[model samples]
Target: MVEPLPHVREIPPYVPGKPPPARPGLTSYKLSSNENPYPPLPGVLAAAEQAVASMNRYPDMGCALLYDALAAKLGVQVDQLAAGTGSVALIYHLLSAYCGPGDEVVHAWRSFEAYPIAVTAAGAAGVKVPVTADGRHDLDAMAAAITERTKVVLVCTPNNPTGPALTHAEVATFVAAVPAHVVVVVDEAYLEFVRMADPVDGLALVRDHANVVLLRTFSKAYGLAGLRVGYAVAAPEIAGALRAVALPFGVSSVAQAAAVASLAAEDELLARVDGLVAERARMVAGITAAGWWVPEPQGNFVWLGVGDRAAELAAAAGDVGLALRPFAGEGVRVSVGEAEATDRLLHLLGSLEPPS
Candidate 1:
C-alpha cells in the first residue's frame, strides 16, 4: 500500500451526531446536531425544485447569483466573498491557501471539531488553547499562543457544543493583539440565533482588519445543511486566494437557488429562528433552575457540563428516545430543537440529581 503522510495517520476522526434510534411507541427527537428543527420555507423549497430542472447541466462555477444576493445582503463587494460546500470546506480552503508543512494554526480547544481535522489535512500544526470554565474562548491565551510559525487563528463565536459567544469588544481586543500577518477567522455559523448584547460584528472586523475573515453558513439558521452552502467574507486578496483553491462547481445549483431564496425571504426565515431562540431560553432556564450550571447559550443549543457523567446522561436521553451529542467525559450538547424535545430534556434533567 502507498504510504500516507505521518500527520494523516494521527488525525482524529470527526464524530457526527447520531440519528435517533427507533422507539416502538414514543416519538423520537434528534437534538444531537445543532440543526434547525424546522423545515425549509415554501419559497426556498420551490426555488430548489426549480433549480433541479437544470440538473443535466453544471451549476454556475462562480456562484454568480448567490454572490449577488450575498453582496446585496451583506453590503460587501462580490470580490470579497468566496462560497464553498460548507463553512468546513472554507476552513480547509483558508488553511490550504496559507499553511503548509511546519506552519501553525491557533484556535481554542473544544471549539468546532473540524478545526483540528482541517489543520492537519493542510499539513499545518494545530495550537489549541483551552476554553475558560464558562466554555468561552480564552482570547488572551489564544493571543499568547501565537508565534512566528502561526499562519491562522480561528475564533468560533457562540461556539459549537459549548455555547458562549464573544462580544465586539472581546474580538476587537483580540484582533489588535494578534500580529498583522496572521489570519483571524471569525466563524459565525450561528449568527442569527444570537440575542446577546454587543455581539461580535464579523463584518466590522473584516472591514477594519485586512487579516480578518468571516465564515457564515445556511446550514443551522436556514435549514440547508443537507445542501452544504457556506461562504467567507474577507479582504479581496484573501478571498481570491480561497476561490483559487476551491473545488470547481462545489455549490450545487439547487443549493445556490435555495440559499438565494432563503436570503430573499430572510425576515420570515428569521421568525423561525426567533422561535428556536425562545426554546433555547426555556431550556437554559429549566436547566439552571434544576441547579445545573449551563453555559450562557447564545446559539440554538445548550451545554451540560456533567463531567464524568456525560455519557451516562446521554445514554439516559437515548433511552427516552432523544438523541443528544455527548463528548465522552467532557459534557453533552443538546440542541434547542422542538418544544417537545425541550420538554422531554427538561424533564429528564430535572429528574436527575444535579451534578455537584
Candidate 2:
C-alpha cells in the first residue's frame, strides 16, 4: 500500500468551470468560463499555422526570439522576463521556488481557486485572508496576517469569482507595507478587461518593487487560451529563479509564434476587449436595474452573491441551458459571452425579483 504525504492528503484538487455542450439552442450558450467570446486574430492564426509546419524540429529551449520581442515591447532587459505554459503554471513555479514545509503563502480567499492548490502542492501552508464584504481585497488585514514564515503574497486584481479590482493607490499601499524579502505576485490575467479609474498596474509595481512580479496571460485578452502561453516580469534574479524551475520547451514553437503575432496585432485585439468591456457593463447595469445588488464587476464576468442559494441559482441557470460557474454554498459567476448569450442571461436575471 502506498501512503501519500500528509500535506498531499490535505490538498483539494482544482475544479475548472463546466464546459458548454454543443447543443443547438440560444439558451445553450456557455457563460461558465471567463473566456473571450472571439476567435484568434487572422494574423495570429497564420503565424500558428506557419509554426505547425516545423513540428519536426524541437522548439527553441531558450525562447530567445520571444525574450527579445518581449524586452523590446516592455522596455525591460530580456533577463527580467520568463515564459511558461500558462500563468497557472507560472504560479505553480513561483510556489515551488519559494515555498517548502513550514513556509506559508498568503492570498485572498475566494479568489483564484488555483492559489490554495498550488500552495499545498509546494508543501506550504496556505494563509487565506478573506476579502471585504464588498468583494475587494482586505489589504490591511492581509498585511497584518503576514509573519516571518510567509514566503509569498498573491494579489489578484479584477479578482476571479467576485470581480472587484484593486485600485492603483490600494495596491501601492499594500506593496509598501509588505516585507522586502516576501515575493508579491499581482495576478493580472483579467487586467486588459479593467475599465476602472486609477486601476492597479502590475507592471508599474514590478518596476518599482524588487520583490514584485507581474503575471500576465495571452489566454484572456489575446484569445490564445487554447495555445496555453503566459509570462512573468520581475527582477532579473527572480526571473532567473523562475526559469530555473520551469519545464524545458514548455512554451512550444507554435505558441511562441502565436504570441509574437498576437503582440504584433495587439491594437486590434484590444479593440475586441473594448467590446467585452461594454458587454460586462451592460450585464452589470441590466442586473442592477432588476433590483439585484452585485459588486461592480471590472472583469469580463459578473458575480451573483446568492450565498447559500448558490446551488439553486446554478440549477435554475442550467434549466435555461446556461452553464454558469457556481461556488456551492457561496455564490455564482457568469461570464459575458456572445450577444445572444448575454441577452438570454440578462433576460433571465432581470425577470427575477431579488433583494437590492
Candidate 3:
C-alpha cells in the first residue's frame, strides 16, 4: 500500500524567488524577492556576532528577550506577542491552530503567493476573493464570500504584486462585517514602507478586537530576511493558540539577537525604508514613462502587466544583466534594488524591443 496521505500528491510546492546563478557574473539583480537592498545595520551585526560565539548552545526556546523588546516597542503585553522564524511561519501556525478539513480561509487573489499554500497544507479550503481593478482587496466581496466554514480572513495591505493599501476605514468595515467566529489577520509585512494617510492600524485592532491578529516581519524594513524573524500581535488567548501550534525554538538564537538589536536601531532602519520609498517612486516613474502598464507600486517592487511579452522582456532584462520575477503569463515583478540595480533596470527597459 502507498504509505501516505493521498492529498499530498495534489499539492503544489511553494516557489520562492528564482535562484541566483551559480557564478557571480553580471547576470542577476534578484529584483524578484522584495528584500531590502541594505545590509543588516551596525548594531544588528554586532548582536549577531556575539550570538555566533555562543552557537554551541541551543537558542532560548522562549525567545524571552526578543519578546520583551517587541512588546515594549509595540506597546503590547508579553502574552499578546509571539515570535516565529518569519511571518510566513506565523501564517502557517495560524492555519494549523484554527483550520482543518471542511474549514475555509479567505485571502485576495494575487496577493502573497504563500497564503493558499499554507491553507491547503493545513487541510482547509482556500477562498480567494478577487481584488478591485485598482488592485485593492474588495473587502465587501470577501465578507460576502464567508460562510459558516470560514475560519480566517487574511488581508495584506499595500498588497503584494499590486500596490494599493486598504485605508483604515475600509479595513475596519471589513473586520466589523466578518463573522465573529472568523479570525482576521492583517499581514503588514510592508507596513513600514507605507506613508499613506489613515494607514491601517492593525496594532489598535489587536488591542481592541479579540479576533484580530497583526503579523509583522523584520525581513522587510529591518533588513533581516536571511535571519528570519517576525511576530504576531494578538489578544493573549489568540497569541497562546498561535504559540501552541508553533514548533519549540523555531527562531534561531542569532535571529533573536539581531531582531532585538534591530529594534534599538529603529531610526536607522526607518531611514533605509525612507530611501526605499523614494526608490519605489523612481521605479514607478521610469516604468510608467516607458509606456508600460505598471501597477501603482507602493511596496518595494513594481508589477508590470506586460502580457505575452513578459518572458521576452524578462529575457531581455536578463541579457542586459538584470533579474526579474516572472509570474502567470502576463506579469513580471521587479523588486526595487540599490541605485546601481535600479539604473540597470531603467537602462534595460530603454533597450527592450516591442513584442513582435
Candidate 4:
C-alpha cells in the first residue's frame, strides 16, 4: 500500500465556497465566495482577450512587464516583488521556502482557512491564536504564541469569514513586539474594500521592515478571480526566497495583461469599489435593523455570528435562491452582491428560526 507522509495525511482539503445553487424560475445570487460582484473594468477584458492570441506561447516566467508596472504603481523596486498563481499559492510558497518538520507558523484561528492548509502541507505546526469577541485578531495572543520554532506569522486584516479589520496602531504595536527572525506576512487580499479609521498601510510596513511581506491579490478588487494572479511585496532577499519556490510560468500571460490593464484603469476600477463599499454599508445597516448581531464589516462581505444555527442560517438564504458561506457552528459570511440579494437576504434572514 502506498502511504502518504503523516503531515500530508493530516491536512484537511481546502474547499472553495459552494457555487450558486440552481433556481428554476427565480434569479439566484451567490454571496458565498467574497467575490467582487462587478465584471472586469473597461480595457481589462479587452487586454485579456488580446492575450488569447499568444496562448500558443508560454507565459513570461519572470513576469517582467507585470513587475515593472506594479513596481512603478506600488513605488517598490522590481526585485522586491514576486508574482504567483494567487495569494494563497504565494502563502504555500512562503511555507515551502521557510518551513519544514518541527517548524511552526502562527496565525489567528477562524481566520483564512488557507493558512492552516499551507502550514500543514509544509509540515509546520500551526499555532492558531483565537480572535477577539468582535472578530478581530487578538494580536497580543498571536505574539504570545510565537516561539523559537516559529518561522512565519500571518496577519489577515479585514479577516475572512468575520470581517473586522485591524487599526494601524494595533498592527504597529504587534509588529514592534514580534522578533526580527520570524517573517510576518500581512495578507491584504481584500484591503481595497477596507475604509476603517487608521487603516494599516501594508506596503509601508513592508518598506520599513526587512522581515515583512505584504501579500495582495488582483482577485478581489480588480475583479480577476477567474484569472489567478497575486503578488508579494517584500525585501529583495525575502522576495527572492518566494521566487525560489514559485511554480514556473505559474501566472498566465492573460492574467498579466489583465492586471496591467486593471492598474491603468485603476481610477475607474476603484470607483466600482466605492459602489461596493456603499452596498456593504447598506448590507450592514439592513442586517442590524433586523436584530441579529453582526460585527462591523470593512471588507466587501458581512459576517453573521449564527453560531450553531450556521447551517440553518445558510439554508434560509438558500431558500431565497441566495447562497451564503457557513462555517457550521461558527457563523455565516454573506458577500455584498446586487441590491436585490441584499434586500431579499434581509427580509429572509430575519425570518429564519433558530435551530434547537
Candidate 5:
C-alpha cells in the first residue's frame, strides 16, 4: 500500500452540518445550511424541464452560452467569466492553479470553512487571520500578514458565521496594499443580502484590478443550491487559469440552463432577497428583544455567541424541534428560513431562556 502525501496527512476533514435526529411527535425546522427556504422560481423550473430533453450528450465543455448570458448580466466580457459547479469549486480551482507546496494562502479563521480546505488541497500553507472582536475580517491585519511567500488571500464578505461585511474604502485599502504577485479573491457568497449604504462593490473591483477575482453563486439569492452553478468574474487570464484546472464539463448543462433562466428572473429573485432581509431583521429583533446575545449578521444567518452555554442552547433548541448548526468552539449559526420557520425559531429561543 502506498502512503499518502505528507500534505494530505496533515489536512483535517471538513465538518459540515449534522441533521437533527427524528424524535417521535417532534417536527424539526432545518435552518442549518444557509439555503433559501423558498422554492426555485417558476421560470427556472421551466428552464430545467426544457433542458432535460438532451441529457444524452455531454455538457458544453466551453460553457459558451452560460458564459455569454452571465457576461451580459454582469457587464463583463465573455472571456472574463468562468463557470464552476459552485463558487466553492471555483475557489478550489483558483488555489490549485495559483498555489503550491511552498506558497501561503491567507484567510479569516471561521469565515468560510472551504478556504482552508482549498488552500491545503493545493499543497499550500494555510495562514489563518483571526476575526475582529465583533466577528468581522481584520483587513489591515490580513494585509499586514502578507509576505513574499503569500500566493493568494481570500476575503469572505458578510462572513459566513459572523456577518458584518467590509466597507468599500476598507476593501480598496486592503486590495491596494497587497503585492501584485498575490491573487486576491472576494468571496461574496451573501452579497445580495447586504442592504447597507456603502457595502463594497466586488464586481467593480474585479473590473479595476486584474489580480482580483470576484466569486458569486446562484445558491444564495437565486435559490438554486441544488443546481450547483456559480461563476468567477476575473481577468481573462485568471479565468483561463481557473478553466485549465477545473474538471472538464464541471458544470452540468441543466445547471447552466437553470442559471441562465434565473438571471432572466432577477426581479423576482431580488424580491425574495428583500423578503430574507426582512425576515433576518425580524429574527434579530426578536432575539435581541428576548435578551439572548445576537450579532447584527448581514448574511442570511444569525449568530448567537453562546460562549460557554453553546451546547445547552443548541440542546434546548433541539428539544423544541428547531435544527441549528453549532460551530463547535464558536457560536451557533442559524439560517433564516420562511416566516413559519422563523417564527418557530423565535418561539423556541423565547422558551429556552439559556442562562447568560
Candidate 6:
C-alpha cells in the first residue's frame, strides 16, 4: 500500500453540519449547517435550470459572466477577482499559491474549521491563536503570533461556529501592525448577515493594502450553498496568482448562471437575509432572557459556550428533531433556521439548566 505524505496523513478531516434524522411524528429541521433556510429566488432558480439545458458543454474556464456580474456588484476590476467552487476552495487556492513547507499561516482557532485544514494541505504550519472568551478573535494576540516565516494571516469576521465579528478599527489597526509582505485574508463568508456597528469594510482594506484579500460567498446570504459559488477580491497580482492555481472550470455553468441571477436580484435575496438576521436576534434574546450567556451573535447563528455540555445539548436537540453543530468539550453552534426550529430550540433550552 502506498503511503500519503506525512503532512497529509496528520491533517484532520473537516466535519460538516449534519442533517436532522427522520422522526415518526415530528417535523425535523437541519440547523447544524449555517445555511440559509430559504430557497433560491424564482429568477435564480430559473437561471440555473436554463443553464442545465447545456449540460453537455463544458463551462467557461474564465467564468466570464460571473466575473462581470461580480465586478459590477463589487466595483472591482475583473482582473482583481477570482471565482471558485466555494470560498473554502478559494482559501485553499490562496494558501497553495503563497505557502510552502515550513511557512506559517496565522488564524483564530475555534473560527472557521477550514483554516487549519487548508493551511496544512498547503504544506504550511498553522499558528492557531485562541479566540477570546466572548468568542471574538484576539486580533492583538494573532498579530503577535506572526513570525518571520508567516506568509498568510486569516481574519474571519462574524466567524463561523463562533458568533462575534471584528470591528473596522480593530481589523484596520491590526492590519497596519502586520508586515507588508504577509497576506491578510478577510474571510467574510458571513458578511451579508452582519448587523453590527462599525463593520469591517473588507473592500476598503483590499483597496488600501495590496496585501489584503477579501473572500466572499453566495452560499450564506444568497441561498446558493448547493451551487457552491464564491470569489476572492485582491490586488490584481495576488488575484492572478490565485487564479493560476485554481482548478480548471471548478465552478459549473449552472452555478455561474445562478450566481449572476442572484446578483441581479440582490435586493430580493438580501431581504431574505434580513429575515434570518431578525431570527438570529430572536434566538439571542430568548437565550439571554433564559439566563444563558452566549456571545453576541452577528451572523445567522448563536454560540452556546456550554463547555462539557456541548454534546449533551446537541443530543437533546437531535432528540427533538433538530440538528445542531457541536464541538466536543467546547460549545454548540445553533444556526438561526426556520421560526419553528428556533421556537423548538428555545423551548428545549428553557427546560434545561443553563451552562455554568
**lDDT: the better of candidates 4 and 5:** 4
Q: What is the C-alpha lDDT of each candidate?
A: 0.94, 0.89, 0.85, 0.90, 0.87, 0.93
Model 2 clash pairs are none
Please tell me which model should have the higher TM-score, number 3 or number 6: 6
Top lDDT: which candidate number?
1
Q: Which whole-number lDDT from 0 to 100 does residue 67 have in model 3?
A: 93
Candidate 5, position 314, lDDT: 73
Q: Tens-digit lDDT track for model 6 on 199-274?
A: 9999999999999999999999988999898999999999999999999989999999999999999999888889
Worst 10 residues of 4 by lDDT: 347-356
**Tens digit of lDDT per residue, candidate 5, span 216-295?**
99999898898898999999999999999999988998998998988899999999899999999999898887777665
- Regions of model 5 farther than 4 Å from truth: 23-26, 353-356
**TM-score of model 5 vs. true structure:** 0.96
Ranking by lDDT: 1, 6, 4, 2, 5, 3
Candidate 2 lDDT over 196-243, as tens digits, reads 799987778988999999999999899888888999999999999999
lDDT of 3 by residue, 1-356 (tens): 75655545545687687754333557456787898978777778999999999999999988999999988888889999889999999999999999998899999988888898888888898999987776778888898999999999999987987777888988988898887779999999989888777999998887667899999999989999999999999999889999998998789999999999999999989998999999988887876666555656667888776767777877777675677887767568888888878888887776665333
TM-score of each: 0.99, 0.97, 0.95, 0.98, 0.96, 0.99
RMSD of each: 0.7, 1.4, 1.9, 1.3, 1.4, 0.7
Please provide, for model 1 over 109-160, each residue's C-alpha lDDT reduced to its tens digit, 9 standing for 90 to 100. Answer: 7889999999999999999999999999999999899999999999999898
Worst 10 residues of 2 by lDDT: 20-29
| Pairwise TM-score winner, candidates 4 and 5 | 4
* Clashing residue pairs, backbone N/CA/C < 3 A, model 4: none
- Candidate 1 residues lying further than 4 Å off, grouped into runs, are none
Model 3 CA deviation exceeding 4 Å by range = 20-28, 353-356
